[model samples]
Target: MKSSKPIAGRYLGYREADRAAPYARFFNPELAPLAPHVCAALDRGGVPDILLPDIDQATTNLFGGEAVLEDGFVLTSDGGMRVSVRSAMPSVTPAMVDWWFGWHGDAASKYKLWHPQAHVHVGWRETPPAGASGRVLYVGQTSIVDEYIGSDLIRGAIRFVPPATLGFTDKSLDDDQQATIICAQIGLGDAPIDIGYLAHHVRAVPGGSEMRSRFWMGGRHVAGRNLIGGMAAVVAKRVLSVTESDARALLVHCAQEMPHLASFLPELFGEFKDAE
Candidate 1:
């Protein structure tokens, strides 16, 4: 929101936006009014309850494709936080979700299209290997991005992984047909240490698809690259743990980005899925 792109600093100003891309219509260059549902979800509050970092059981709830804590943030008892946001995406599919994730990381322009106001820049480490397509293009790749969770600018690494890696044992998950869940390990910048986990579960619905996004930030998932880093993380954990404000910010970010993405994802995918 400050400058449309990051202007300076370590993780900022890496890439500039391509204003003349064919995907321009796929997203707005500005923010629109929050949808009514989004407003309501932000109004109501969520508290951390039974699903306290127990992702195996929580993944079961997600597979059902029903609304469970449909929206809002939960401050976990373990000094971590969880954010839940469900977006109803009309005419969007699980395959499109996969394609979008894989395709967007290729350029900062495409990444900005997901959330113009919040997203600043993005770069891919190793993506779309030879002979890899669809979900394969991104499932094993890592994307480094500079974006805003709320008012704070964050530079983080998102490493996509298979559902089995996160304990989503549903038999139908092997393919991205009926449902597609994008799971990732979240880290601070390019560091080898992982600090969080996230899953965006896009399940088939009657009209289109619904994405149930979940984030588990901090808690036992936080780790370091080595023994020295581990000690640093321990000290940092006691001093600067995730809080309610962090959860609320993440909830708002997810709530905004997904719907904006679904708005034009179908058309975007249809046009560029094969070529791009």
Candidate 2:
């Protein structure tokens, strides 16, 4: 259930910060406001109903091969949907957000640390049941390997909470308002880490959807925490700088596979029009 290996990596040579900083607080504020905006924007447009073929190829290209997903689905008694996808990516990097959003580029690759055999369990149910909560759960394997840390596997879990729970109201929201906020905590097996949190706001645009993720790493101490934390920061910064380009690449790949979605390509890459 938990990683048994000791935290012995060469990257642990750096001195600890003079003062430990506060965790969780860093990401909550910024992401709180942005979640509503993103959800509203997405509502105005629409969530893309991507085909299974598109998803399969996009996932394959995202990891750069050496990955496969198992098929399985389950239904909860509350009429919710539960999907389990097991994947094995031998060349996975430590850029958790980029990996989660399917971003794989030179910048993303620079943060490569280790490969992981991950099994993700996703569960979600619909809303509008009156006072119902819109949430989802994602649990998978976590690991970072280098000459110093070797190869110790860690279990990670993220829970997505509804924006309404955070005091967000649907008043003035568009009739198709499908916007939502996601607050996720990264944990090692059953033990939660205070080093940082993952906040992502996803919205539907004209042609496709847009997702912005902010990872705030404060100060937390766990086994091999410092080493993994440092690597994550490096990777996060690199991915953030090239987010537009990464989004374009992902869309282009999807378009190439599904020609019908090509028309939305321009809209998806609109933000990067000048860059091109």
Question: Which candidate comes out best when scored by TM-score?
Answer: 1
In angstroms, give how far residue 262 of model 1 lies from its true place.
Answer: 0.4
Report model 1's TM-score to 2 decimal places: 0.87
Candidate 1 — what's its lDDT? 0.75
Model 1 Cα displacement at 134 (Å)?
8.1
State the lDDT of candidate 2 residue by residue for 94-201, as single tens digits: 122222322111111211211111111221212111111211122222322221112333334333434343333433213223333344444343333323344333
Model 1 segments beyond 4 Å from truth?
1-17, 35-37, 51-53, 64-67, 132-136
Q: Each model's TM-score, in the order given?
A: 0.87, 0.27
lDDT of 1 by residue, 38-144 (tens): 67766776655564335656665676675466666766666777777788889998989988887889777788888878887788876656344433378778899
Q: List the residue pairs that clash in candidate 1.
A: none
